[model samples]
Target: MKTVNLELFNNPNTVNKLSIAIKNESEKLNKPIKIMHICGTHENSIVRYGIRDLLPKSITVIAGPGCPVCVTSSKDIDAVINLSLKKNVKILTFGDMLKVPGTEMSFYKAKSLGADIKMVYSVFDAIELARSASKPCIFFACGFETTAAPTASALRDINIPDNFFIYSAHKYTPNGVYALLKSGKINMDGLILPGHASAISGLKVYERFVEDFNIPCASAGFESVDVLLSVLLIIKQINNKKPKIENGYKRVVNYEGNKNAQKALEDIFYLTNAVWRGLGNIDLTGYELRKEYARFDAKKQFDIVYSDNYIEHQKGCRCNEVILGNINPTQCPLYAKLCTPQNPVGPCMVSDEGTCKNWYDGGIE
Candidate 1:
C-alpha cells in the first residue's frame, strides 16, 4: 500500500519531454492525423492544459461521444421527467443530470414545478433514500461502463429495497465507438481510449478497432504528461504502421480489466441499441436490466414507453455536431452568448465533463 505521487504525473519537465517526443513522432510521418478521445475527462484535461496548442500542426485531437450526460438521449430525459410529474415517482439522479435540457423540460425545471427529483452522490444514496420512502423511487442511471459497473455491483451485492427501481441510460463505450466508426460519421487515424471506463472494461474489448479499422488505440489518464505520452504512443504506432490497443494509463487500466465488475455487469444487464443525444441510435450500446432484475428496473416495473420523436438539442444549439467532433463549441451560435454555465441551451453546456462546458471553462480562444 503506497501513496501515488500526483506531482510525478504532472511534472512540467516530464510533460515537456513527452511533448517533445510527440512532436518528433509526428514529424516522422509528416502527415495529418486525427486522434479522437472518447472521454469527457480527457477533453477537460486537454482543454484545461492547452494540450492542443502543444501539438504539431499535422496532428489533431478531437472529442467524440464521451460525456455520459451529454450523450444521454432526450427521450430518456423526457421519460424520467414524465415519471416524476405524471406518475408521482420520486426521482434520484446526479447533480449534472438536473440541468440537462430535456424534450419539454429539464429536471431542475421539473423540480421547480413540484417534481420530486433529488440529486444523490451515488446509487447507494438512492437505495438508502428509497429504503424509508413510502413512494416508488427511480434512479435515473446514466453513464458508461465506469458508472454502470458500480450500479450493477450495488444491485447484486446489496439488499436493495423493493421500492427502488432503475431507469438505465447506461451505455457501452466500445460498441458505441465501433458503431460510430462503422457508420463513417467520424474519420480518425487513432483513438485515445477512456481510462476510467477501460479500467472496468479492459483493453481486450478494443482489439477489434485495431484489427478491423486499423486504428491505434491508447488508454490515457487525465493528466498533462499522460495525454502527451498517449499521443506519442499513437504517433509512434501510426509511424510504424503497427496499429494496436496500448495501455498509456497502465497504473489504473489493465488488459482484461476488473473481472468482478465485468461479471456484475454481465449478470445484471444486457446490451441493446440505445439512442445517443445527437448521434441517433447505435446498436448494442445501451444497457437494459435483465429479466431476472425486472423488479429493480423502472422501465419494466413502471411500464415506461419511450417516444420516437423527441427534441434532442434546442434550436441554434450545435450539441449534436459537437458530440460527433464535427464542430467545436465556438462554431455554435449559442455557445457563450445564449449558452452559459448558469444558463445552458444544450446538453453539452450542462455537464462538467461535456466538451462545450470544458471549452467554456478553459476559454482557450
Candidate 2:
C-alpha cells in the first residue's frame, strides 16, 4: 500500500457539500428512500465518519451482510471446533473467529479447553506448520470473495502438504444479496456495492442484477467522500427513475475486475448451495474446493458433518435479523448491555465490519 493523502478522499468540506446536495436531491422523492450497503468496510467508513448522521431524514441507510466472520454459521463454527478437539489435529484460522459465539461454544473457548488451534496470518503459514508437525493441520477458511480469491490461489498455485487441508466457508456477496432481494426480505432503493469485493468480481457480474431488478447500484470505495458521492449518484438515479449500474470506485475497480484472481478462484473452487445465518439455504453462493483439489479439503479429509441438534449458545442474539437488515444493531436487546466487544454475544460484535459492533463502538450510528 502507498502512503497517499487520505485527507483528500475523506475531506470534511467535500463530505459536507455532498451531504447538503444529497438532502436537496432527496426532496424529489415522495417517501424516504432506503439505501443498503453490502460491505463491512463501507459500514466502518459510514460509522467512523458519522456519514449516517450527515444523511437527510428521508434517506435511511441499512448495513447488510458484509462481514465475512459475522455470517459464518454456528454449525460451521462447531464443526471446526470439533476438528480442533481431535487428537494430533491442529486447526488454523484468522484471529476474528476466536470469539464469535457459535451454537455450542466458540473456537476461543475450545482453544482454552486444550484444543490444538493456531492463529495464522495466511494459509501458507498453516502449510509450513503442517509440514513440520506430525499431525494433520486444517485451515478453517471463512470469508467472502475478497479473502476467498487468495485462498483459491494458494490451493491452485502451491504444492499442498498431505496433512494441510481447508474447511471452506467462502461465499459470494452479490449472490447472497440477490437471494435477499428475491426472497423479498429486504427493501433496497439503491445498493452501494462493495469496493473490495468489486475488485475481485468486477462490476460486470452485477450487471444481470442491475438489468433484472432495475436497482440503482454504485460500486463504492471505503471513504467518506467515495461513499457520500456514491449516495449522491444513487439519489440522482432514483429521482430520475433511471436504474443503472455505476462504477463510482473506478480508482480500484474495473468492469472485468482482477481477471487473474477470478481465474484462480475458478480453477480451484466451484459454486455450491450455501446456508447463510439469517437467510438459510441460498443457491449458488457458497464455494467449495474443486473435486480435483479434494485432497486439500478439510471437510472431506476429516469427514466433518454439521450436527443437526447443535444449539444456539447465545440466548438472544439477533445477528441473523441484523444481517438481514430487518433490524438495527441497537434494536437487539443484547447490543451494548450484554454483547460488548470484550464479551460478544453475537458475531456482529466480534468483527470491526459487523453492524452491531460498529454501532456499539461508534455509538448511535
Candidate 3:
C-alpha cells in the first residue's frame, strides 16, 4: 500500500493564495517567464485540473519531450510495425503504441491488416505471454527511467523465454531536458522536474542542468497543489536570482533517488546516442541493452530492416515544434482539422500524454 498526501494544496482557498502569490511574483519579474515540464503524467494533471487557467497570464507552462511514445522516431515505429507483419511473430506493446504513427501506418492499422500485436501493461506480462505463446513474441518497450528500471529488473531476475524478444525505446528523463535546453530548442525561465521518473533516477541528476543553465528546478509530483506550489517556488527563485534544485514532492522524491532501481539500469543497459522523433539525435541520451544481454535484443537477433530516412514527424504537424517549446499545438495548421485521437496524423495526437492530446482533451482556452 502507498501513502497518500493529505495536503489541501488543491483547496479552493489554498489555490487562491498560491494564485495571488504567483500574480504578485509575476509583477516582480523582469519579463514573461516560461516554465517547461517534461512529463506526460504531470501535463495530464495540469490540464485535467485546470491548473493553467489559474496561473498568471505572464507565466507560461510548456511541455517538452516527456512522453516516451511521442518521442519514438518514425523509423523505429516502422521497424516494429514491420516486425509485427511477419508470420508467427507478435509485437507486444503498451496501448498508446497502438495508434502511434510509423511510416504510413500504425500498429493498430497493421493489426487490422492481420499483424499480431499484443498490448501489455508490464514487462512481466510479456514474460508470462512468452510462457504460453506458441510463436515468437517481442516486447516493444518504451518509457523513461521509471519504466526502464522495471524492465531491467525483469530481465535480471527472470530467464526470458526463447520466444521472447525486446525492442527497447527507453530514454533518460533529465537527459532529454538537457538536450532541449543545450540546443536552444526550448527557451524557458525554469524547469519542473518529473517526480515519478526522478524518483527512480533521482534529483541529483538535474544538478548539471541547474549549474550549466542557472535555471531553477523543482521536482514535482502529479497533483494540482504540487504543480501550483512548484510554480510559486520557481517564481520566488527567479525573483531572488537563486538557481537551485528543489524538491516540491519531497515525500516521494529525494536527493539520491532509488538506488536499487539505478543499479538495475547500470547492470542491464548502457548509455548511447538515441534519435528522438522531433528532437533529433542526442548523445548519451538513449538506453541500449548491454553486451551480456545481447540475446534479449530483438533488433540484432531478427535482423530487422528500416530506412534511415529522416521522415520522423509529419511536415504540417507542429509536434516537433511543440516538444521544443517553439510553438503551441493550436498554432499548428493541422491540429484539430486533420489530427485527433481517433485518427491521428502524428505521434503527439496518438499519445495521451502528448501536448496536443492534453490540449485537445482538456480544451485549453
Candidate 4:
C-alpha cells in the first residue's frame, strides 16, 4: 500500500529486471543468505507479488516482529478488556486489534459479552466519541512509530477531551530487532528496515545494526520492485563484504526521518521497557505517556493492573516461533488444520499484515 508509484513500481518489465539482478547478485554469495524484513506491509507485498519465488534458493527473505497487532502483549489486551467491562468506561482501538486473542478473551469476545468496545479508524475518532459521550473513553493505542506519530501529533495539536485517555501499547521497532539479533534469537545476514517506520525514525536508528552486527541493512517500500531492489542491494553488500544501511525506498523515506514527527514523539511520550507478545520485554522499546500528560494516561487514570499469568498462544499454536522468524506458518501444527484467517488460533493469523494471514491469502498452502 505504501508505494512510490504503484503503476511505475509494479511494472512487469521493472520487476523482472530487478528479479534477474537479485538472482545474479545472490549467485555470487557462496553461502546461504537470510534477509529479515521487520514490516508487515513488506511481508504483504512480498507474498502478494510472490517475491520469494523470484529470488534464488540461496536467498531467504523472512518476516520479523513486524505487525504491531501480532506483537501486542496479551497482558495489555486483558487490561483493556477488563476496563471495557466496567460500566463507566469504553475501549476504542484499530480494527485489527479487535480479533487478536487476549489471555482470557479478545475485544470482539468482550464486545459480544456486553462490553463497551468499539473499532475506531483513528485516535481522533475516539476523541470525537468521547466528546459526545458522558462516560470515559480509553483508546488502546497499539502500533510502531508510523502509527504512534499520528497519535502523538493529535495529542499535541488537538483539543482532547478530559474524558478521553490513551493506553499506549505503541512500540519502537529498531530496539526490538537489535535485541533479537544481539540475543541470537534471529540469525540473519542482512536486514530490511521498515519503510513507514524508517520515514519517521529514519535510517540513522539502524546504524547500530550495521556497525555492531555487521549486517547489511536496507530500507524498503511496499512495492514489488521496492522489495526486490532491497534484496538485490543486500546481496550486493553481502558479496562485496561491505555491510551498511542502504536506502532502497528513498522516494518516501529520508535518512534523518520526519523531524516534526520525531519532535512530537519527544514532547508527548517517553521510551520505556514494553512487553511484546512472543519476544517478552525489550528495553526502551515502548512509548508511554510523559509525566506532564498524566491526565490523558489511561493506565494512571484507571489504576489498571496486568495479570502475572498471561498466556500468549494456544496449546498447538507456533505463533511465538513464527513471530521470531524461527519457523514459518505452515510449520505450525495448527496453521491450516485448525488455525485460519476465518478462525485464527493465534494473533499471527488474525491481522491482514500477519504472516499467516498473508501466506494464506497468497495461497502458500
RMSD of 2: 1.6
The CA lDDT at 138 in model 2 is 86
| Model 1, C-alpha of 133: deviation from truth (Å) | 2.0
Per-residue lDDT value at 49 in model 1 = 85
Q: Write the per-residue lDDT of candidate 4 for residues 1-365, one digit (tens) a residue.
A: 66344789899999999988887777789999789999998999999888998988898999989999999999899888987886568888999999999888899999999998889999989889999988899999999999999999999999998889999999999998899899998879899989999999999999999889999999999988899989989999999999999999989998999999999999999999999997799999999999999889988988797789999887888998999888999999898779988788899999988999999889887
lDDT string for model 1 (176-207, tens) is 98988989987788999999999999999999
lDDT by residue (64-176, candidate 2, tens digit) is 88899988888788888976776568888988878888777888899899998888887777778888878888888888998899899988888878888899999988888
Of candidate 2, the 10-residue stretch with the lowest lDDT total is 305-314
RMSD, each candidate, Å?
1.1, 1.6, 1.4, 1.6
lDDT of 2: 0.86
Residue-wise lDDT of candidate 3 within 1-365, one digit each (tens)?
A: 88675656567788788888889889999898899888988888998888989998889998877888899888788887877776569889999988988877889999999998888989999889988999888999899998899999999987888988889988887777787788787778999999889899889999998899999998888878889889989999999999899999988999999999999999999989888987788888789999899899997889688887747777687888887767888998988889988889888888888988988898753
Kindly report which residue pairs in candidate 3 clash with one another: none
Q: How many residue pairs collide in each prediction?
A: 0, 0, 0, 0
Cα shift from native, residue 76, model 3 (Å): 0.9
Candidate 4 residue spans exceeding 4 A from truth: 1-4
